[model samples]
Target: MRHAIGLKIGPVAFRVGSDWAGPIAALADLYRDYPPPTGVPDYTVRLEAARPWRRWIRPSVTVRGDHMLPDALPLDLAHGVLAAEIGMNLQLALGERRWLLLHASSVERDGRALIMSGESGSGKSTLAAVLATRGWRLMGDEFALIDLATGAARAFPRATSLKNGAIDEMLRHVPDARFGAALTGTPKGRLRHLRPDAQAIARMDAPAIPALILFPQFGRPEAAEAMGPAETFVRLTQASTNYVPLGRAGYDALTRLVTAVPTVAVDYPDTDTAVGMVEQLWAALP
Candidate 1:
């Protein structure tokens, strides 16, 4: 708990403390553009050594804080930045109750939002990043927050985690983007972090009305199918980490979202084609 930093990303604030300086420094560099969080943070994440000797010899970092997994494994110090990121995700996923959390990515155009939800390898993150470059505001990465009081899509544009090939793809398009070092041998494999565009950071607090929802799947022939409310509701509930915890408020909010917004499932063979499909879909929205 020696080296630490506070971050304000949209509706959430995080205070991450580390036993070593490297992780904190790395995180600070990645989130340099963000404003320092004021007042008490919504969640606290701690990076600690397994034992006293571990800090000095063969250093390792264990994620701990307000909410923790009982059997979470330790991560090598070399991947401390990832550890910190994972720690923040843990706290947010487990502790957040203010907004209805969806494991999705989002972008905005013309003051309305486009949310893409899918499982790992679905290309949602890459799609969001690509869309951000093609004239869409990056509203969020990894999670999409829906305000319970108002059925609006709040921006939570944290640094986007680009894995393996994604790192190269993003680098090519976002030439001036600031990126964290590629950390190899992690569970998800050679992942790097990309800071959100300046526009995303500057408008972190802005909220957009949800206009479209797309479930994108990668490695398939291009196709699009509309998802009925029943299926969309189930899929969204599965994606949300805090749906059940929010109870009736969560139910009402999600129902409003599903009924008011149309949902689609799209398949694409690559990023370029995916972008085209998304734009076409966006244009078709009524």
Candidate 2:
């Protein structure tokens, strides 16, 4: 099949078309030991081998998709690689713009960014949906790119993946919310997309200043609390998997982040209280 590569990810431009040869040529760029120029790829590889060695990829090499196969595949198997590919590229692309990718959920309000970061099943996605339904702009439900130099946050617009009763709970509160394309039976369970704000969706590549860095822990009801910027920064940096990968560049970036942004921790039970609590925290930001 012939395909056109439209996305520029890191140093590689993904050129896939209707032709099977499209992926073949794109993968060829992955063979090189040095990072190629803008259009030329550094190396390429087969689809099956993607997950294990993805971390070894360097700007020095361009990875092409040489799997020469149809897009049709089992939903569960396909989602993992797809997520890995998308996540890797998202991290690289935003890094070029000086953003540090944080494994967190982020939403926006009145032009400022509020981040909900935590381990899996920590209720970050649920909180994001609540904020979205309550009139806050949904930046992303999974990954948040924080500009280390400026303490600004950018959107990584994608479907919010909710699981179990979380979906029903969201529907109860936000009957009008739009769910994106369904991707089911994955490792993370059946996943679906939450409709993103059209305007926020359009500005996915744009960055907004960080107003609040929140570490959300959803459970028994409690008053919303604030965490010191220093503590918040420590936790955020610790929670990150790539912060150390960036080394000195990473440290400089993270320091700038806590110094300029107000980092906090929030805990609550239901969506109503969580939304109100987040609002109070944001209201105090400049």
Candidate 3:
């Protein structure tokens, strides 16, 4: 570990070490506003060169961490920031157990959380990002932390990864927003990272009760429908990364969430329309 940086995103902390200095430097600049990680980190992520010579001859960053995929591929050095972000996310997805990690984005208003879960290209991230710009506090854009005991939604506000058309859309919405270099030709295709707003970074310790859950789908006609608890529970089980690993705790927490929170499946054609729809749905909440 030649170069390293420690970061604390809400309840979790990570000490990331890299063989090259580039990734660490990039991480420092991007996460400049985050609170410094304290004590021993919750997990460790190593960004290492695939081979000794490869560090200089076309560097490749291999994400080796606390928990890993046996056959995961290494990323090119040019995508060091992406590699580092991936490394951190990989650790949480494979290692976290204290809190239920949902593959979703979240925002908050009046101490109530709005959680959106969907598959990739479902525009959850973009919707959360746009919502954040309009008075909503961005809780997270990748993973939402669901507390096991309280079922509260904790903040995990990392830099939001904007891909494809989303990059241009955000650029238009926030012309002066902090954005990382656009890394093209990556696995996810034409990606960029948008730093979270200052309020979100500064108040990362706050947690909110889950008031609403949305299964949002993009590239569709506008519509909204209530989801039964049974269907919501099943969909969330699929969305969760550590549901089975947590056993009874996960099961109980998830059941409570699905039954208590008003879950809805929403469809929309664009961010603007989705924003209006979201406001309507949230306002309808008790």
Candidate 4:
């Protein structure tokens, strides 16, 4: 193995190159821990054959092996370690800045922002793609980093993972949208990386203070109902990757965000309805 890149995510650092360097270094920087005390990443990966674009096994990890094969090992072993690393980095980078990585899908229009948080298979990414195609700038999908002090949200503009029916669902809206090859047999079914809007890619690492925290749950019929601040706070913490890991820093950031911003809950049946609800939310922003 050749050490092609070097990075530091808080306390942990990595030296790897070529085939595994980019993803490994990123994993180390983003998550910050390895599998157990061995300090080796524990995860299998499927690369996009481009620059810095990949889908993570919910928890990703690196290990000592002659081959980086995806199907050879237990998924749990890798997921645990890699997820820890990504979670750690998320806490360090965002938490230090008093930001929380709200587990949500976020997009921006004009100057307003809407964050849609939900579990996997909730069509968050599909909605994000729809908004981006309709000219709403993509802020982030999967994670929305909210700046506590300024009430802004940052963008972690990685590839949008589309799975199962979502691939065709988004293609209908974004006919020209580019995508990486499909990766199968992992967690989210058959998944592909949807390229972000070019401008959003340029501002991938940028952060913005939020105006609204909308928790999205795609249901039978499209609808959005605003939740109280207190309920939003609990959900925010639960949605975070490193809320508890950063201890005081994470807690303080979440408190500041919930207090300063108007948090709400939303539900929509399909991508179109979700995007419409988001647009409404943005229009109502002050």
Candidate 5:
């Protein structure tokens, strides 16, 4: 841990340390606009060589922090940026308790938030990134933080992780300066990190009411369906990382969210169609 950087994204603060300066430098550049934590960081992520000898020969980064998966595999030095990102996510997923965390992507418009959650291949991240560029505020792409007391969605707008074709699509719309280098050979295939716009970073502290909950699936025939409250509750419980641990507080927060927000399931073959469908849905919101 020779080099380190502290960053505050929304309400969470993280201190990322690395044995090598490369990862730390990359993070500093990417999160340059973000502010430092007010005081002590909420979490600390360490990137170190798996073994002391490995530091000099064929170095690899082992993600270590307050919460870690013992069996988690190390990443090559080239992918250290991604390793750092994953490390921060690990700490939040395992340790955060102040907010009800949802494994989803979120965007906001006119004080209303849209929450999109689905399986691995779902287009939530890509969709959120696209919407952010089209006048919507990017709340977050990895984890959507929900205030347990007010039922509002707070911004956690970290870099948007774009995978496979989504990266190229985003490149077509966004400028080069907004993207990280294309990361190849990732476990999830070709990936790139898209930095949220300055507007998103500037308004990171603003919270929006949860107005829509969407379960989106890409590469499917275009269709939209209303979801029942029972099914939505079950699926959301699965989507949440610390739902059971939070017990009644988590349950009540989630219950209020599902009850208050409109839920929909969308299937689309392409991004344009999906965008159109989402626009139509938004227009019809009561």
Candidate 6:
């Protein structure tokens, strides 16, 4: 690897090295505010050419790291930044055991956290980005870290990956300097990474009490339904990346979360309605 960059996002630290300078430069710019790892990084991601000769040819990047999928495919050099980001996420998904990792986006207000999880088009990431711009503190966009013992939501404020229309939507509220270059023709379609607000980066270490859990569904007629503990438990277990790996500890942590937090399933037609729905739900929380 010729170029390398180290970044710390909340509790997780990552060292990413690349055979080409492009990926490293992109990461350095995107993660400019994040500090390097204090000691050793929690994970290391290496981006190398698929073959030695391929380095200067029509280059493609192979994502190799501490943890990887057996048959993971290589990505074009143009998408090297995405490959590095995915590599870091893969390491945590397959290796982390320190906290109960939820495939959710989270934000905080008044020391309380609101967690939102859903499928690919859930709009949770966009909602989180908007909320952070509004008044809530963006804790995380990809994975919401929940303490096993304390049940608090720890901040993991990485750059928000906004896709398609979501990108245009965020550009309206967030400043131009806060966004990364647009990348097109990726697995997730055209996307851009939005740097979290200054406040989110500054307060990335703060932890908030788990106050609400939401399963948000976009493009639906507006509706909000209460979710029972059993349903919430089942949904979260499926959403977690390492629930089974943590064994009984994971079970207990999730149980505590489901029981203590008010869970709801909400459907909205657009971002504004979705935001209103979240606000209403939060206001109604006891």
Best-fitting candidate, measured by lDDT? Answer: 3
Tens digit per residue, CA lDDT, model 6, 82-123: 998899889889999999999999999999999999987899
lDDT of 2 by residue, 216-285 (tens): 8778666556677678778878666568767777778777777767776677887778778887877777
| Clashes by residue pair, model 3 | none
Candidate 4 structure lDDT = 0.59
TM-score of each: 0.98, 0.69, 0.98, 0.68, 0.98, 0.98
State the lDDT at 45 in candidate 3.
91
lDDT (Cα) of model 3: 0.92
Clashes of each: 0, 26, 0, 27, 0, 0
C-alpha lDDT score of every prediction, in listed order: 0.92, 0.59, 0.92, 0.59, 0.91, 0.91
Model 1 regions lying over 4 Å from their true place: none
Task: Give per-residue CA lDDT, model 1, range 217-283, as digits (tens).
Answer: 9999999999998999999999999999999999999999999999999999989999999989888
Write the residue-wise lDDT of candidate 4 on 1-286 in tens digits. 3333333321233333333344444444332322222355322223222222322334333332222333433333223323222333343334343455677778876566767787887777788878788887787677776664565677765557678788888778765337655556555466666767666755544555567777677766766676777887788888886687667777788887777778667777777777677777777777
Instruction: Give the per-residue lDDT of model 3 (tens digit) for 23-62.
Output: 8998998899888988999999998878889889888999
- Winner on lDDT between 3 and 5 is 3
Candidate 4's C-alpha runs over 4 A off are 3-98
lDDT of 1 at 195: 89
Q: Model 3: number of clashes?
A: 0
